[model samples]
Target chain A: MNELVANLGVSYGDVLLELSYLLAAVFFVVGLKFQSHPLTARKGNLWAAAGMFLAMLTTLFLHKDADGNGIALTNGIIIVFSIAVAGVLGAVIARRVKMTAMPELVSFFNATGGGASALVALIEFSNPNNSSTLVTLLGLVIGSVAFSGSLIAYGKLDGKVGDIFAKWTTYLNLFLLGIVITIIVFILAGNISYDSQKLLVYGLLVISLIYGVMFVMPIGGADMPVVISLLNSFTGIAAAMGGFIYHNQAMILGGILVGAAGTILTILMCNAMNRSLFNVIIGAFGGGGAAATHEQGTIKEISLSDASILLSYSQKVVIIPGYGLAVAQAQHICHELDTLLEEKGVEVKYAIHPVAGRMPGHMNVLLAEADVPYEKLIEMDDINPSLPNTDVVVVIGANDVVNPAAHDDPSSPIYGMPIINAHEAKNIIVMKRGMGKGYAGIENFLFFNDKTRMLFGHAKESLQKLVNEIKTL
Target chain B: MEQAFEFFYANKDAIFIIVLSVFLGIEVISNVPSVLHTPLMSGANAISGVIIIGGIILVGHADVSKVSVNLILGILAVLFGTLNVVGGFVVTDRMLEMFKKKK
Candidate 1:
């Protein structure tokens, strides 16, 4: 096979490799374009996977170093075996992960990619023939930061980690960041002796890892989506550095694309909450301060039968869902109620707050799993105008998004944050396990409004009872 | 310092590709609806797995004579990169599969 390939000319093999990489790049672009719409999203994923397969196959078979040596047989076996085992492990974990756990899973995957890139940089830096120290250092530092940072994000999302939430953490983070930059500059200045280069590189790696941890330590849980997005961008840039190291167009394009996607998401999440990225990074929001001390008003309870009757008689009803709905795993039952209400001549729609649930568009995915109609899921801005005309607004396992304090209570932490106008509707019925405070631990002033009626129960049970009552009516 | 400039001069094409890709990426992804955010993110995450190609190249050239640093790191890189690629795509497909129009 080697003799045949040499007979075919080394330049021909290089041409084949480059052409395959170009084709893979095209596939990625088309796949990303297709992902913008729901109907083609799954097909888009397959297309991108095909591209990945082609790139990996071509690299494994045709890759040649500057001396024209193909991969040794033993090394090839190692590569194939590692890929096969890791691929199976990855596919199994992804298939088994619950939809509610998707955010953390994404974080975990991002960390792996970052780790791979960082390792690549580490190996290259130790190579005798390495030329681009700057690119290698960058890939090493950025990839290390992304890897450790994402793991912390995963731990936080899994409820295994707690926020530090101290004033000094911010200054500490900044100080560490300054040190990282200073070290990078010092190494690049070339004043350090060659004997200490290895030590400096390892030191940079350690400091970057520490910086990554501190960077994420103080951020509250509510800002996780943004942090995840930002770290994802870091991984992408780090991968691009690998591309720069090897002069690989596929890696370059792929890295930039992911970097852009993560940036867009980060900005979108920030806009959804009416908060700046700086504010989110500084960890000043969603800390659950003294907002709960003020007495609001008397609470009114509503019976299941009355709730059913209210739904049955309403001309139009809007459902506001939150992380609570996800926790109770009530999305399917919630959908059942929506279907039942629609059959009773009541128009039903779901109002989705951008920051609702745990991640960006988290509630939509949950409802989609329950097979809710796509058209019925209205965005917060679009649904707010129609809310005043809505006859009934049912708040299910949700609080802060509809708390009204976001709009009226300037003293509230969530004051300027956008919320679904569930308070504006004629009648409000809130389903909850109890009068417990929301994830942010802020008091929901909507509960005290005259139009509001509390229906206390686990979300799934309450939704089931409401469905049954409506059926009987 | 001279070496840095030489590096840029040698890889100008790669730099151009990076710049153009950034704009194209922003353009293609800007209009994705909120409903598809999770899937879109996961899909992009999978694409970052393109680093797997780098891992393969490294592993292919590694000195495998008795557990060298190159061989170990190369194998680990391939493993992690493959995991990111396969897991990211599979999970994304799972999410998108749930997003069917009401039947």
Candidate 2:
């Protein structure tokens, strides 16, 4: 029956594999598309994930042996166990990690992917029967470079290496890279024997690792997010090379898509940081003289009830939550404020920056838990346009993401990275217990913006008071 | 019928790897944001680096008739693999250091 199915120009396995790939691709496209806008982004992600699951299941079933038994059952069991262990580790980290460290964790994961693909290629190459053609060598070299490069990027992102290394490592790396390439070319020209070629490959990998280390050493902590995106592109390219060597259409296509998407993101991140990709690579001029210290001037503190009353009267209110909101677990309170505003026919939306709340999507998950309608969550780009229309931008424990220094002060640590334009709103209301610097340890200029008002107290307490005032009014 | 089955056996490994990687990739995409992609990629790269182990195993059992070039290449691949593993650990350890509590 299976043979008949295979011959009738209706190979069920191909149909299933193609369908799975199609679905995964669809999901990838949709999810990535929605990532730019927070409104429908969560649903977009769920859709993408559903597609991926379909792909996984279909592909698994298609890999059956002639007797319809699954191939490598023992290997499959081992894989499941490894995945379980990894899952536990990931969950533990997610639960325990603060919002701030989320980016570094993401960087860690990107490094892992690059390393995995490189290792896979290496294993394949070790087989004597495998062809040692240019294609195989290309795959091996590219994958190795990406693996080491991404690991170094992860290290730098974690702040294990100082920003100064990013400053001076570029030229030295370029010099070494030149030597590695020269040796590789000489071997390829048959000027060296087979042993020499092997030595050259090792030399290439060593140079690549050193290059990776030097590449990321100089970048400032502030620019880590962009670096993560760039490294992600490298991983995708390495995977594609593996795909090429293996002659898998799905791997090649999927890898190509990821590589392209990652590259675009890297460019966008670079633009956001206001630095050319070249400059970021060289780790030019990280930190110092950029952020101005505000005068320890009189800070007027408003009560929660007064703040709530002020918020209710506004035609439009934009809630900006920061790390403090995450620390206080005030997402639910913020959600309540949104509901009350909606009941009063007031327009309410939450403005979120990419790096807002410590992790990549910390604010999204927190707000999602509070049952905040996904559509009401606004990303930096969308919120920037709406800030002018907004009557009140109610900042809940936010600081760095809203700092105007990104635009006005080139000397600040966050000079070029994209930020939420909450300062552009008609009125800015900040809720905090006291004046403290943001993650970058800099005072916020938005706090002193002419239209800004500081409401001093715990974020949840303040929001609850505001909710009460709205209820009464 | 037996010959048809033999063809399947001959091509099974290639088919298996292709099917597995694609499926795993889809699962990864569906369940998580690309944020975790880095670690996954790095892990895979590390696995590919295991070619060095394969090389060592092959070299240990290699017959005298085998090309000396293969042996040299095998040694080089092993060296690269070791460097990749060590470098990966160094970098990852440095990154994990960020989570340490500051005095």
Candidate 3:
């Protein structure tokens, strides 16, 4: 293998490898462009995967060492074996992971990518001839933070972690951030001798890891999508540092793309909640607080037969879905009820809030999984206007997005946030097991509206029973 | 100041690529509808797995004959990077598969 690669010559291999990287970058850009619409999204993903496959295959065969020689057979075997095992493991896990758990799975994958980048920097910095200290250190710090922060996010999303929202947590996070920046400056100041540089690097790594944990410690569940997006950007920039260190064009382009995408998403999530990104970072939102204790009006209960009749008779109905819908795994049943209503000559559409579920667009994915037509799923802005004229609005396992408090109550924690205007509809039916605050831990005033009727039960059961009732009606 | 200029001059091409790619990324992603947000995110996450190439380079250059830090870290990097790349793309494809037009 070595002789064959040696015959090919270093310049030829390097040129071919660089060309492959360029082709891979093209695939990624085209792939991302294809993602703008649902029709091209799956094909776009395949293009990006092909780009990844080509880049990896080229690297495996054409990669040259400092001496301009192909990789040793032993090292090649190690790379192939590790990649094969990890690739199979990743595919199996991804294939079997539940759709509702997609957010945590994304966070878990982001963590591994960050960990890999950090390890790359660590290994490079250990090299005696390494000259790019600043780039390496930046990669180390950013990668470590992304690695640890993403892990905490995964834990939070998986219900394995709890929020620690204390006033002191904010202070503690800021203090650790200060230490991390200060230490980085000290290390780069040239005041430290070479003998102690490794110690300082290790110290920086540990502090950054701690900072990552503290950064995410106080963020409530509702605000997690923003935090995850922000950390995702961090991982991208960290990978870009690796690109800078190695002068790798493919890494630079791919990293910048992800960094920009994550930044846009973070801002979008913050905007959807009508909150500033700074406030989200300071952990000022979500979780139960003084605001949640405000007094509420009496709830009215509606029978399944009445709810069924209301839906069956309505000219137009909009179903607002939230994280609760995903929790009950009732998407299929929900779809069935909607399909039945459509058959009855009643118009049915789903209104999706930007941050409706655990992650951005989570509700859309769940509904799409149930084979809901792409056109039937409407964005909040698009659906809000028609919501008023719609004869019936069914609040299915959703709360925060429909809460009237976001519009009318200034003192409310969710005030100034845009809502679906469900109160404006002529009839409202809310499906829930009991009167519980939303993930943001705020009482929903929409439940008390004159037109609203609470239908208490698990989402799947309620939807199933409703479907059966509608059939009888 | 001179040192900064020298560094910039040496890496100007890379800097150019980074600037253009950032704008391109923002332009392309800004238009994505909310319906495709999850899949788009997962797709970008997979692209970040390009760091797997970096891992491959590290591993290829590592000395396999000895129990050294380079070998251990290099192998781990490859393993994690591969997981991120393969898993990210596969999961994204799975999500996108569900999004279909009305029959």
Candidate 4:
């Protein structure tokens, strides 16, 4: 019976399964296209979920093995149980994670994607299919690295681990890469027996894991977005390798999309920070203290009443938020303050830098959590030209992004990086906790500019104070 | 080992499809606005979570009802893949839910 099914090469159930996968792939493409905009994004998500459900149900009920035996009844139950448990856990966590912790959650989830792909390659290789050996090995290497790298990124984002930059660490990572490649070449030679080959493969996995951890250990928090993006690309490519190994078309389609997206995102991240992919890979910048060289300006302070009056009467106000806003959990109050200012007829908008907060668009999500209108949020370039004509610019807990030194001061480590142009406004009021440098570890000259007044305090407390004062005025 | 290359060579159509899909993927995601980049990343993570299919096939076709290395690994793959897909889509939806157009 199995031989007969094989000879037919197009069983009815198999043909139906293939069509379902094709439908699922089409849904994925359309879903991604919808996700590019705010209006249809929710429907797009549901469409993709439907596709996933369709593919999963078909696989569970209709899939047959090379021997043509249906899924073992007990294994089917176990598979369902595992999926249920994981889906519930994921849904609960996703619901529970705050906007402030989105970066950590994203990093952790990317790790799981990488880990799953790696496990697939590992299990398949344990059985030693000769024809798919190369792709399996390739998947194992990339997936293992992405898994470890993403975990390290999560740790750094959560502040659980600190940078461990040593000149030798970079060399150590490169050395491990060399060993990984050498083992791949040896395995491809096929001189070793199966048992010994398993040991060699395990060796490769361990080294790849080590290299991944080391690869991320040297970079500081500010560089995390690019690292996360690059690792995302790695996971995508790794999953694609699994698809190739198993002849899975859905995996192939999904993996390539993610790979392309991740790669593009990484490039965009580098461009946003005015850095090269090579420079970023070299693990340079983001020392957190690398920019603390000069202290050549007098402190300028703003009184609470004066700050409130200034904002309440301003014709236009642009607010710039940063990682500091997240640290203070002040997004809600900030939005409230913006609302209050608007009621008084002050035209208010937010200038969002791409690298603001921890991840790409991290600040936007944070502000959105506070129910800020999407139109009030403006990109850096779109808002910069408007800044000079603006009456006042209020900067909240943001530092490096609003620094003027990036355009001048060649000696500054952040030179050539684009900033918020907060200096261009008629009045620049900066709200912060203290006279600390930003993530790049450099002092912001904009604070010393004659047009700037520093209103130093906790971001939430300061915004709350300003909001109260605005009502009184 | 040479046969592995031969197998890949025989699947030329799959290769062509994969390569073409790669370009399509890049083109589609290349212009995702910076604001949606995080959701895009999370959403794509969910899509790649389709590797769960690969895991399902692996454990399902193990040819036995008893415990084996394959069984354990397949279960683990299912768990991770499900978490990725579910967590990714749920979080993306959660984020998108908060976005409202200006009144």
Every candidate's DockQ is 0.82, 0.05, 0.80, 0.72
Task: Say which prediction, candidate 1 or candidate 4, comes out ahead on TM-score.
Answer: 4
In model 1, the runs with Cα more than 4 Å from the true position are: A1-10, A193-195, A286-295, A409-416, A439-441, A471-473, B1-10, B101-103
What is the per-residue lDDT of model 4 for residues A227-342, given as tens digits with 9 covering 90 to 100? 88888888888888878877778778878878887888889888988888887778666544434566667779999999999999899999999889988999999999999999
Worst 10 residues of 1 chain B by lDDT: B94-103
Better of 1 and 3 by TM-score: 3
User: By the lDDT metric, which is better: model 3 or model 4?
Assistant: 3
Error of 2 at A375 (Å): 2.8
Candidate order by DockQ, decreasing, is 1, 3, 4, 2
Candidate 3 stretches greater than 4 Å from native: A1-10, A286-296, B1-3, B101-103
How would you encode candidate 1's per-residue C-alpha lDDT over B9-42 as one tens digit per residue?
8878987888898898889988778777778888
lDDT of each: 0.88, 0.58, 0.87, 0.85
Q: Residue B36, candidate 4: how far off, in angstroms?
A: 0.7
**Candidate 4: clashing pairs of residues:** A291-A441, A291-A442
> Interface RMSD (Å) of model 3?
1.1
The alpha-carbon deviation from the true structure for residue A183 of candidate 1, after best TM-score superposition, in angstroms, is 2.6
Docking class of 1: high
The superposed Cα distance between candidate 1 and the true structure at residue A276, in angstroms, equals: 0.7
Better of 3 and 4 by TM-score: 4
Candidate 2 chain A: minimum summed lDDT over ten consecutive residues — where? A74-83
- Clash count, one per candidate: 0, 48, 0, 2
**The candidate that achieves the highest TM-score relative to the unseen native structure:** 4
